[model samples]
Target: MNTTFGGKPHVLILGGGSVGLTTASELRKTLGTEVAITIVDPRPYMTYAPFLPEVGAGSIDPRNVLAPLRKILPGTKVVTGGVSAIRSADNTVVVTTEDGAQLEIAYDYLVVGLGAVPRLLPIPGLAENAIGFKQVEEAITVRDKILANLAEAASTKDPKVRKRLLTFTYIGGGFAGGEAVTEAEDMVRDALRYYPDLHASDIRFVLIDAAPFVFPELTEDQRAYVLNQLRERGIEVKLETFLNSAENGVIKTSDGDEFETDLLVWNAGVKPNPILMDEESSDLPVVTERGPLMGKLDTLADLRVNGAEGPIDNVFAGGDCAAVPDLASGEGKFCPPNAQHATRQGKRIADNVARSVQGRPLVDYYHKNLGVMATLGMYKGVGRLMLGDKEIDVRGLPAWAMARAYHVYAMPTLGRKAAVLAGWASNLVSRRDIIGIPQSADPRAAFELAANSGPKKK
Candidate 1:
């Protein structure tokens, strides 16, 4: 590490997700005016993904949940680009800009916070038919698509067309799938007012999962309550059934059940960005076939990538992307890929990186599972909380409150949090704004053409 204040050591951070911003804040706190930091990510802003469901349901403006990285990281330089490769040997990173230009950046230290991408499963026509929930754009697209489908259903005279347009399928039983179903259901319920012909009964909402139960984190009693709530509302919960195929509007489940659906949401799971798995960086630890092991042995103390000893010196990694060992589980287990784990990983990695710079002993990652929570439309929900040896079950308003409260704090900045609050307050009394903004590849092309054809006075 460079020990000169006039020529401070350069710190380069890849990816501007939740982990990246948190790491930058902590690093700035420790390094002070001693080190220069630069962050690179494709998007200019960091999105609070917990609010993505709200955006998808049109309960909040998509803009309210995203915080600009440039505004947040004032002292640090923010580069709007994606890191194509990380070369640990020379302590350099190659990045590709939005316009397809490439540049090499050298760093004294590298923090690889490259976050998870939506896991696309191998299902027939899934690529063309299903939408994955990961970004703010996907959420916005979901909002527009659902509303358009409802409008189409209301106006169409053909029974087959109307049925196909109204049927919605969500594949996955985790928080993303559960929350999305609830939010979308609430929006569809509210939208019924605008459609004179379409009743709440006409809209079919189905939640499918390969797992036997919904919300795997919840206790048996709480799980039962969640299932009952969905059933009471006439929402179909298909457990142990996977999505066999979804071609256009046609959907077939693994259990021979078939339906034609307008919307197919694949919230199944998430995998680390595949770019990192390439053979370019031999510094990265060999992961197991299931993408679990960080090193040869699953339980590597101190979060160090195995093979090469001594912290990999310059390069560091954490969050969902890396397999950090969980001490709570005595077995050789990695932490679950969730917001709680990701947030904690950010802190530990930052502290460890700082310790490495100072030539101090590094600490291992160790945390107990805190259970989970899920919202099931409006006031209905279910959850389990692990406090010491006691485990408490919660449902209804408590679960709803937990879901909202956790995410409110999770949202990036003060401005975004306030805007989200305002959106919630307004949504209680008003209907959703369901206008569609069709995306065009050449967004400014029309304007340019119009300017050229316009009558001009010389």
Candidate 2:
């Protein structure tokens, strides 16, 4: 609204993740300087999820994986806040800004691209003890916590304390889950080589999941290979297991096992944004059965908001938040929330939005399924690449390169690409830093103690 647009329509984009930013990028090219665009997200940046494993491994710098929303969108307005409520009927959004101030924003169009959150279950103490691999900060913190555990173990001579400090349990065997587990384990084991007091066996890295195999997209053979490789490294893989509870580093599983550990990484699954997905309470037009958008739009073939009959006017959705029909699946399945589809959906969303506003013929979105890829660690990975009619199964170095190449090629902004590339190149030669900063369990220990203290105790 502050920018000079000469009465041109304003577009409000919710969330600054892959879909929202992509929509903004494409919109800039499609609508030019005529239209006003505003993007709202709780954080100021977008965390490139694919590189999170490397971040946890200390292979890539954390700064490189985050893309600042305002920095990327030069002329567009970037609101740093969470969307508390969407007044669709009034074309207004209630946003809680970064400084905690509330603002009511009016828009001619609304784009719902609020990405998903980690799908958490009501397992006891799971919420308090387990950390996820969703954001840049979480990834970096995991790395730091692992390194800190090593330092803690090294500083102590007690075997029980050292074992508890060194044990790490990861839940989930999906792409993010596997990548985070393997990559972090690799880094930790390599760090063990430097410690005179520690052996690789001293560090227990256990991966627990409800699935019998890892990497859902990979062939059975590939999954077996991954399994074998992990076992060969002395990593514990527990399958078809349910996590019962976790508290004070003690993990109780459904498989009649008890483990004490200092860390737990939960990558079970992700649900759509909680507030938006709440059908009973939320005003957001989310389909009850569809769950939280999960990064796709409930749109027509042309990416317009789907009404009971046809496209609705002025409303749109895209990214992991939309239940977009997967044309590639051909089974009436929605597109799985992934980078490839979200990136493609963003462009089409922008184009369709422009066309709708201009009273022009809309373009439908249809994309063939691009095969999936996952990296285990540096120089280790598995991928299914689809090129024309040839389907390629890549493993080891080739798969690693393929994964890196695709991610770097897809990573937004030349600066971010360069940063990741430089960090990776540096990683090949530089020694991994073992320093870890401790995260306090009590966030306000000093404040509480101070308030309780009056002069000196008698």
Candidate 3:
């Protein structure tokens, strides 16, 4: 180990999502010049997730929503690679680069903010038939696919083929599924003007969830309003219904019902990023109740990972990867994996890391609930805001405006936010760009074709 700490302990943060970036920034601010900081991840930028729906709808350029790490984090050392292994015994981590190069990084304090990935279930044909709704590329790809399906349906005269192309199904009713379906539905409805033969009525939209509600974030009254609104728009809201199989655009529901569709969106749920449970963490610390370190609250703090007994030092964890308890609710349920909580916890983790280095007292994290909002379609939305003791529900354009305003402020930077707003304005004034960039189906076929080609004779 290089002992050139210069009396400053080195801090290493994993992942580059909202939580990781926020924590890094906070640590830099609180530690003054005493701490050396480094952040590692495969990507060099953090994506502003709330604007993802707008990106899918082409109302915002995807580039505007992602903040490059080198740009946003000027002082922190940003390493672009994956943390391949964690050697906890020696307090060192192994990171692998895209070119097969690897390095061992030593840290006095380590924060694991590796965010969650989409949960893949063991259902047959799902890996091939369904597409996930996370990530910027998925949003753009879905937009292109939806528009392409529309074009194909309009050109085909066969009723069965057209129906198959126009049908779309989403398998989860959470925030991701709700936003994806709503934004896609709204854009397709508007783009129908280009296809004179296909109207909104010709398209089929189905939202299926095993749970009995659409948005778990909404109040009972607000949830009911959302359900009724979706029904009024002629979209099927199938609750308590789980998809058994989707083969060749045909889906079997839990109720033994079957349907044929072109699009299948899987937003069911997310598990901890597998990297968290790797060999690096074989003897890593965990939060537990009634331990020697911090008490029951130790396991529930923002960054500190308590052992089977209590708080463990030199390591921290947060975001969707850690099961941080919600103090607001007396129940022991872990905080739901949402952008709101992750962002907040990230800041707290940074502050705590800085404080520990300075030998200062660390603080506990407690937050009140912020209401949830969702857009149904063009000018329609629902919001459930928590007041002192009760919840207030609103719908229609007001809710839509609220949603837009909240996201505008929540965007990473002012400049990017302005660019997104400009895109929205431009979209309102002109036709939607629905062009698809075709990619080669068989990448290796190019090499084969090149090898087979002979020189042309003059």
Candidate 4:
């Protein structure tokens, strides 16, 4: 470790997600002005991921889910780029900036919270057509795309074409997929109320999952309740089913069913950041087929990366990128890759890093997961709550309220929290905005093209 720091003991964090920002916040508190902290991420803000479903549903404004890193982490030097490589051999990181420039940063301490990317399968047409359940842009694009379908449906006369435009398919039964389908269903239903031609029955929401149950995290009762709740609203719940192919706007399932649709949400799961497995990050010896591993950087209980001889001396990692052992769980169990675990782990790792720098004994991280919840759109939801020594299942409005309240509390800054609350409050009185705005995706195509062409120069 760099003992002599003229207030510049560089601490480089590889992500800007929940874990990355939390680590920066805690490190500031623990290290004070002793070390220089820098965080590099592809995005300028830390997305409040739990609100992604609401964003897609148009229940929350897109900006509400984004907490600007500059505004949130004041003392930290935030780099708008992705870490292309993490070479632990000499404590150096290669960052590919947003402008396509490469910058190498030498760090005395490293925190690899690179986070996860969507797990996409080799399903036909999925790569070219389907939208992901991650990222703010994905949520926005989904909202626009679904609305665009409605616009097309509203203007069409042919039954088949209308049906094709209105048909929606979601592949995956996890929280992302569950929440997305439900929210989209809700949004489209709301939209149909205002459309003169499109009837409620015209829109078909199909949720297909390979698993028997939609949410594996939910209790049997909760799962049954959600399934029934969705079906009651005309949403099709097809379990033990797989999407065989989604090619050329034709969606074919393994159940010998085929349909044409413009929308398909792929939210199967996520693998750890591919950067860990890339040639740039090869020197760390901290990667596996598992993507993220605790022993990769060979981290000790105190968060210091352990090498063959002893502590690698400076590098530390957590979040979805590390396999930190879950001290609260039973023997040989690692923390689950979730916001709850990652947030706590990030803070713990940060504090330990500060202590390690100060030549003090480091402490191990331990935190029992308080609960897990998934919103089912509007006043419906499901969750497992941990109270005292007992764990209880909640559903319906109560579950919805609990989930919203927790997410609001956890949403980064007070400004963002207030913005989200305001959006929700407004939603209660006014109907959802159903205008199709796919141009938001490109944002500048029209303007750029117009500018390129001489503007009334005659």
Please give the CA lDDT of all the candidate structures: 0.78, 0.83, 0.78, 0.83
Model 4 steric clash pairs: 286-296, 293-323, 294-323, 298-306
Worst 10 residues of 4 by lDDT: 289-298
Please report the TM-score between candidate 3 and the true structure: 0.90
- What are the per-residue Cα lDDT tens digits for candidate 2 across 306-361? 75555667778766677787766676667778888877888888888899778898
Error of 1 at 213 (Å): 1.5
Judging by TM-score against the true structure, name the best candidate: 4
TM-score of each: 0.91, 0.92, 0.90, 0.93
lDDT of 1: 0.78
Mark the 10 consecutive residues where model 2 has the least summed lDDT. Answer: 289-298
Candidate 3 at residue 111, lDDT? Answer: 83
lDDT (Cα, tens digit) per residue for candidate 4, span 155-272? 8889999998898888888888899999989898888877888888888889998899988877788788888888998988789998888889798888889999878889887777
lDDT of 1 by residue, 1-458 (tens): 54432477777888888778888888888877667888999999887787788888887798998889999888988999988877777777889999999988888877777778778878899999888888988888877778888888899999999998889888997888888887888888878887889988889999999998887777777777778877777789999998888876689988999999988888988877766776674345547575443322222456655544545766666676777777887777678777787677677767877887788988887878777877666666667878997887878888778877888877878888888888888877675675655433357987899889967989
TM-score for candidate 4, residues paired by index = 0.93
> TM-score order of candidates, best first?
4, 2, 1, 3
Clashing residue pairs in candidate 1 are none
TM-score of 1: 0.91
